[model samples]
Target: MPLHSLNHFKSVFIYDIFIQPADQNYLTARFLRVIGMHQDFFWHAQQTLEKLFKAGLVLNGVSVKSKSHELTKLLPIYEETLGSDAFNSFDKPKKLKAELWSDTSVKDFVTKISALGSADARYGLVGYQSSKDDLFKLDQLVFKLRQRTMGLDWVIGEDFRAEENLQHFNGKTYREFIEQNPTEQIRHLSIPYQELKSIGENTQDLFHAWNFEFQRKSSDIDKIAPGAIAPELAFSLSRIDALLQNIEAFDGFDKEFVPEGFKWLLDNVKVSSHWKKMIETYLSESKK
Candidate 1:
């Protein structure tokens, strides 16, 4: 089978496995056990073979048996593409620079970003100060363009003091600390609870029709509660707000100070409705 045919299920399974870590070798065994093959070694083997074929791995023109080696091979590609370490070490910085420079005429970059098969793949730096530099670059580009147009002293002021405070607040660089521990990074990236709640309330109003089920009945108490908002929905919206705030702060100086790269970043900021729906479904199902 062509790799493209396997795209949908492969991505879904890989994401579940990555976010909810399980022993790869034991996956076949656990699956077999669930299907009532715990005591039947032969049945276990057969089922494993079937799974391997379904997963698109073949050997000698036959579906390969699920062995440790074959399973390990699938592991690295996913880790490289979807893992936090992979994003922090390789993809994020490159993406940040690319998006900043892409500006308005960055369709290719947008398409590439859209191809990323992860929920958290939209912006390079979510809540960190490193992202500010890209914003600064955009501001400079916008300022320069305005200067050329108006022929005036239109210089954007640099926020060096704020940048320095972010840099030296702790003993180490923010990226270094974030890379060292992702959970901590998430905590550091999080907005205040009140702010997140306010956003949820605001989004609930903007998407009022979408909240119909939650508002329909007084007996549907659980549905109307603040916790009823899907966790991923809340998180994603908060992230978007954070990115917007960063953009606004950077653009506060003047429209002319907008970085040439801001267009690229905006172009690549799309998150598909299908993916968002999937996240919402996952949250609802998990809550149940």
Candidate 2:
């Protein structure tokens, strides 16, 4: 099945774009409010929950209701139908009712958030605009939802079986295939890429580490002489070069912000001791 049509993928994507940013300290509460997209955070979060609940039902072969805004209503029905154990299947939202004024359950906390988006935010109600303090709490809550939703699709045994089959075909999972193939990976990883943009210095290290892991998993490296180019190093260098080339082609990037070292490093790929010394020195300097 195409990834977009999957309910779990849909929910995760919404959470990634809308809720993930809420956790970044760089995005201040005041900035979020003035940015005019605070309401979207709530709206997208609610939609994410709605899709998650529906996916759980559909995967279990239960008929989902046509459309429902009341998450409190949906929760009881889904729990009753699937049994409480299903809640245990994913990373369940942590219990924090004692922290709330009205002694709300974790389930109740989710329902209130759902209401914020489905009714209040959508209609521009007076209380729809969350206060700065409220945004902080909301951000924490959304962060939990985003993390918990990650493992939700694996609740059913069928997804595991299908994944095994997928791995068998190409020795890679659906996600692995997408990661190795960046055009499609961009559709998903863009959110994370944007979030991490604040940390400029480590950008190349992050790419190198991530690409090295992928290459390690899917490619074999043969041992060679000490000064000879190791297959792994050669492959990783090419991957890093490809990434830097793409970054350079990005329109309107300040030339100063683009790592000049990356281009220089790409131009000087070699297996000599001097090349290794250069890399070690460059890495040490990067840390400083």
Number of the top TM-score candidate: 2
Write the residue-wise lDDT of candidate 2 on 1-288 in tens digits: 122123333333333333334334224333445455666656665665555554444434444434365667767766665553334222222563333423335575566667776765677873564533344454444333333333232432222323432444342333343334323211122232234332224534333333445444321222222322234454223323343345456354343422343323323222346544654654555456
lDDT of each: 0.29, 0.42
Model 2 root mean square deviation, Cα atoms: 21.5
- lDDT (Cα, 0-100) at 48 in candidate 1: 32
Assess every candidate by TM-score: 0.21, 0.36
Instruction: Give the Cα error of residue 20 in candidate 2, in Å.
Output: 14
Question: What does candidate 1's lDDT look like per residue over 1-288, in tens digits?
Answer: 111112222222322322112123224434434444323322222233223222322211112223232323333442343234222121223445554443332222212222231123223322211222322332232222111111011111111111332343343433343334433311111122422433244433434423555574333333334543555454323332333345345333342322222222222222356544544444454446
Report the lDDT of model 2 for residue 91. Answer: 28
Off by over 4 Å in 1: 1-84, 87-173, 180-182, 186-261, 266-288
Q: Which stretches of candidate 2 lie over 4 Å from their true place?
A: 1-37, 65-67, 88-103, 129-192, 195-288
lDDT of 2 at 43: 65
Question: In model 1, what lDDT does residue 100 have?
Answer: 47
In model 2, the clashing pairs are: none
